[model samples]
Target: MSKIKQFFVRNKKKILIGLGVFLGLLLVAFAIFFLNRERLLQYAVKKVVQKVENRYPADLQIGKAQFKGLATVLVTDISFVPENQPKLLQIDTVEATVSVRSLFLGRLVFKQFDVANGDVTAFKQDSVDNFSFLYKKKATGEEEKTKDAKEKSNYGTILNRLIETAFENVPDGVNFRNLGVIFQNNGRTISMRLPTLTVEDGQIQGRMAITTDSITNTMYVNGVIDPDEYLLAAKMYAEKAGGIQVPYIQQKFGATMRFDTLSLSITDKVFKNDQLTITGESSAHGLVLNHPKIADEDVFVKNGALKYVITLGNHYYSLDTLSEVRVNKAVFYPQLTYETRPNRKIGVKIDSPNIPANDLFESMPPGLFDTFQGMRANGSFKYHMDFYVDMAKVDSLTFNSDLDGQNLEITQFGEQDLRKINREFEHTVYENGKPTRTFLVGPSNPNFTPYNQISNYLKNAILTAEDPRFFTHKGFHEGAFRHSLITNIKEGSFVRGGSTVAMQLVKNVYLTRKKTITRKVEEALIVWLIENLNLSTKQRMYEVYLNIIEWGPNIYGVKEGAQFYFSKRPSELTLEESMFMASIVPKPKQYRTYFNQYGELRAYPRYFFNLISGNMLKRGLISPSEHASVSSYVNLNGRAGNFIMAKPDTTQIMDTLQLAPIDLLDF
Candidate 1:
């Protein structure tokens, strides 16, 4: 015990020195951290920017930035320049205050954001280059929300957020204090003010107080709208224009409508008098109407004359007339029409006993078609003042004249003919070398289809072509791989592949269409991963495949392909047609050159159809009767000159088919 105490005393000096050195090092570390705080923050910001750019790409550029440790807020000045546009759409120069408390919560608790005092400038371009700041994409569940810096867009994702945010409830759950909007066009400007508004799920609910008076027209608007329904209604509103020839009216109109402070309520109202109690909104930029549920029968049909009120700017226009009114009510009565003469002239006539001819003509303003400037209107009335339209102003005249009541009874006037005006149809071919002109359907095609059918067809096709035993085999096709390598070596070039359908689906959906073995190999791996993923739905897979598949030369989708070749819907394809379609699954363009004068299919490419169908039958994929039907119909020809543009009943035909699966090894 005495020796131990003596040793401790001797080492006391050394122990004190060691403690002093440790304290000195700790102080030095603190000094460094405090001195380089700004540089550290700058570095952090740069790293954040890099990460954001990697995740969410956009044409984003940041200028000056300021961070206050005390307030825990970051102020950044930003400029947004959309891709392909040299002009800047927005510039925020003021302080963008963010809550430090929210940041801490975002880091460890919940994700919430607040923006204060962000000075921004928004630009509206010509018809070709308008700026849109909304993100209208489907939200997936796997998104990460805890990142310090997230990628964003000014026109795309940002706009989408703003739209979604507009419907987001106020944090404190308070009704809006004010909502105001000013719409400007040419020399005319209209303003709408709503002091009180409430935001809820996809709806802005408030009374809009409006007042407007022009030289020739005046309107007052006092109504409530449900913004979500209004959005749907706006889409339907433009569609209601049906055959009207207007230049991007749907896109241009929404920019003028501002609903941040106003709540829109959409409702369906039964009729009372000549008014409709419409509750829903049309779309972003559209006129407000009463809820449909409260629609008045009298407004639709009243003593042979339609009477209704329209709110524009701030005043309401009470209109009662029998003809020549551009409003939709005038056309809903069914037989009403405005015909433009062929001589670049204008005239008005009505065929209603209750509606006096003088009142009808007087109700319509002269040179109404003049607003459509470049388009000219010419022609004289027929025996009963029924005018013949000149080609120049035909589109404008159609717009000003509602198609609802007027059928515009020009016998043999097919609605499909209008597709030619915009070159909506393209020349293409189907199996059996049949040539045809097909319509280009946008996302709004009328075909009713579930997503699965298209996905399965694509999956099966790829599997059959690449690896027949995809379902039963593991990720790799060993036999197919060896065969492919040997065959390539023997041929002295890449001649075949052994990728499965799952792989092809992955390639088509996510990767580029490069014809290389490297890409194919990567695609195969991706396919295995995707198939194993629980996210892939049968319908979703088929829908994507159906859209991406090349059904013919410049033709895509079963809907368009079926319609193009046979002038029939997808459901109407016969057994022979199905076999023909399946036969051409390997190559689309090889048999796309056999069409009649009217762009109708005149023959089928028999070689591929016969070869594939025969093989499928021999492998027991199809029964004897199914094989017989397909063989008999493969090369049959229709009567010459009997082809016409007509819709055929599809339901009965698709139901009549008794198809069989092809053997896996036949291909």
Candidate 2:
């Protein structure tokens, strides 16, 4: 033991001396680095400028760059200009403080940042733009190799990294003065001027003046942002009393949106177990929206809020079922997921359990349910829906929806009486939003045919071609809706609508011809009330539908349609004629396209005849012999024959069978 101790004591001095020498060298190196730090920074900046200029068609310049303190940098006269384009960016002065500790850890973390007198402009003329280069990636001939790599990419990791980087770069304090962002495309220009914007002690305040074309608006924003905690809250409101109007949308996208106040907050963001979860809330008061495709009039929502929990995984993103949406007084929980691995799939689920009937009714946005105004109802209803679709097997999609009302009753009718269809009522036929004609839907009008006056063949054909389960179902056909959803998604457009006869009847009798989401929702609600409440008998509703539906140009009821095409009364129509009439119900304005120039039926209508006849035969609505006897040939003996072409043109034949033939089938 004594020998070992003596050996250790002899070697300890040399070991200590070597450690001291190494420490001294490290200190000397750090001292040299600090002494030439300014030069190193300048070199780095020069290299960055050179790299950027070489990579993009842009030029970057800096008049001066120097360090104010150990961790503070000040730069002057910074500008970026693209080739053959206007000045893209300009800055008079910029100052920022970095965290020395973070720098040692190889991270650039900001403490304080300030910018003065800067302008960022994006201009586009014809097909050229000034700012697109920022997002353009140079082709490396490896994109094809990486095309299938997206399925294996970890979304949660990427998103977490982005969030961390963004938060790290957000300074604890910021001051921006006289900053302007301008956008110009062709002849249109939009400018936003921020005279003063500041963030101090996690609180933010900003005032912006926006100008689009000749209109100017002022908006105020106040928020709290905690970068360290990944929390942010903001409120945006207009300077004036009314809602704030967003610029560029109305002119560029033909849509207008206004909101009285918009509030947004991110409560938390966390990454764990290869999954990222983010929670946030957004609310809007007095929101108004208008688009020709959405509605004719502006749709108004008094109050709406959404509390969302979003999740991201390796190959999927989801809105968790914990997310809740509040519209006026009603609340609903919604869940949605989109996956890309194995096969692309989408799943959506919504649940609103046992909500008050009045709350639901009152929650309907204004201008969407104008007829439902002043309506009072009793009892509550629960709505649930689950939909799943795998892109590889869309035909095997799963969809189920239910809106069950418990002892529901409408005690008071709204603007329109629910039971009016059972009696004589004035029904107006509109063409292009203008009232073309008005007629009585009951016994008072000479052309009005009762249920019995219409031939059973015509009724059966219309039912088979329009809504096969119209009599059995309450108001909606889930299978048809599922099919419609699938078809629309496949086509990437609204090529088919799964409207039942009841919906069509409501639309024609009480609603205008304008096609809009609002109209459709209102139509569905009305159909539900009429059918579920027994306000109108099935026979009466069918009669009304037959009396008011448009069959051809300027042709309004079954009587006019039968006479216009066949010069026969509704009760005198044959099975073949009824099928022809049913075929034209979808595109009445294009009925002439169904015939060749010789006024004979084209080949497309034959598919409809066979489909409808086959369905009828399968349902025993028609005998096998009767179905075999049915023919696709039809003769236009009425005024419709005058519109036929003088020569045969196969190209003019309308592909009506392509327009949802499965929907037309009774099955």
Highest-TM-score candidate: 2
Best-fitting candidate, scored by lDDT? 2
Candidate 2, residues 137-253, lDDT tens digits: the string is 444567844632442377676667677866766777999999999999897888999998899889999988889867777878899998888998999888655548865678878
Give lDDT tens digits, candidate 1, residues 456-494.
Answer: 332333334334565564344544544444444445565
RMSD of 2: 7.6
Shift in Å, residue 35, candidate 1: 77
Which stretches of model 2 miss by more than 4 angstroms?
A: 1-115, 120-162, 181-191, 211-215, 272-276, 311-317, 339-344, 490-492, 589-600, 631-666
Clashing pairs in 2: none
Worst 10 residues of 1 by lDDT: 653-662
Q: Rate the local accuracy (lDDT) of all candidates.
A: 0.37, 0.83
